[model samples]
Target: MRKLVMVSMLIGLGVLPACTRTTNTMGYIVDEVLVAEVKPGIDNRASVEKALGKPSIAGQWDDKTWYYVSRNTKQTAFLMPKPTEQSIIAVSFDAKGNVASVNRRGLEQVANVDPVNDKTPTLGRETGVLEDLFGNIGRFGSAGSAGGPPQ
Candidate 1:
């Protein structure tokens, strides 16, 4: 009787994990939403709003840009364990508010860009960490300073 009860309990416990195991869907659905509804060369502010829905991001620089984005995400495991599906629709307007460019960006074609490009000059910096932190390599020679004679 003891052996049978112990076997049954172990079997029941084994089944519990299978029942509880679930996958966290870490992705969003980007349906067939209108990418750029504004007319490529004729649409103005009012015309653009009439064609497409409200933009996810909209502002003006030298030119005006409207961005429409959709995403579905799931984070099932540790940091950045799941995947995401996303889309970005961008529309640009000329100074006169005529649509200049309409571009579609999918997950595979997009790249994250840093606002400031930190580039090293060709002259190059000092090699060693100590040299970079403590002035030039010749600084060590000036240790016995005050214009004193060398040892």
Candidate 2:
């Protein structure tokens, strides 16, 4: 009986490591060699696409700028994934479609945003729960109250 308990303990110990935090790579996988080949004034939109594939995201207002973003995140069990590393390559295009500039950014640019909780303030008078439940009562006129429509 002791040997059986020992063997089960050993198996549990071996399985514990499998539950450790896992690292995930999300978004574009950048290749330094391909990125180096993209030169301003030489590479156009078509050439850049061929070299780097489709960008992770583009300028929201226009197509003049493209961004290749890569991030590594680590998560444990059911917790939210936290960023371990992040990289962004922004390529801007001139009006003629040629590459105007290439900029590289790292994790320092990331912003942490915490949204406001609870009720959202709106332009209206506050009312209790009971008022909300019966507020619409008697709001509509009776069908006979209109008398005889337009004379």
Candidate 3:
């Protein structure tokens, strides 16, 4: 019995190291994030794309301009830490396709708009997992529970 226990312990010990994601916790640091420098009125669309690849998002609101963004991330397991890093590079241009202004923002520098409270968080609403399991499936989504109501 002792030998069996020892073998199991050894196996468990070997498996324990695999549980972590092997990511650096320091990646969560805000300032450690790398953001590309933008040269005003010099970097154009082609140059921007060559340096930063494709952006996570791109658009224009008022005038003609192009934007590029990039994000990098690292994560860990358990209580260690959740590490994430990202950067957004904005390349704007005039109608003439000349670089206008560059707006670089870090995750910390961006403001949390609270989603404009568009879908206001329900007060005292049924948030229980079990409740949704049996609630209306057509109107409300399936409660995502075992033995939930039939489709």
Residue 83 miss distance in model 2 (angstroms): 0.9
- Residue 81, model 1: lDDT of 29
The per-residue C-alpha lDDT of model 1 at residue 26 equals 27
Task: Report how far residue 65 has shifted in candidate 3, in Å.
Answer: 4.6
Lowest lDDT sum, 10 consecutive residues, model 1, at 21-30
**For candidate 3, lDDT tens digit of each residue in 1-151?**
9999999999999988777565443222222222344465776667755555555456745544454443454545555333255555566777766668877665674444555557866668556786679566555445565565555
- How many Å off is the CA of 18 in candidate 3? 2.9
lDDT of 3: 0.57
Q: Which has the higher TM-score value, candidate number 2 or candidate number 3?
A: 2
Best TM-score among the predictions, by candidate number: 2
Reference-based lDDT, residue 90, model 2: 99
Highest lDDT model number: 2
Supply the global lDDT for candidate 1.
Answer: 0.63
Cα lDDT tens digits for candidate 2, 15-85? 88867899999999989999999999999999999999999999999999999999999998678888889
Clashing pairs in 2: none
Clashing pairs for model 3 are 55-69, 132-143
Span of ten consecutive residues with least summed lDDT in model 3: 25-34
State TM-scores per candidate.
Answer: 0.47, 0.69, 0.49
Model 2 ranges off by over 4 Å: 1-18, 116-151
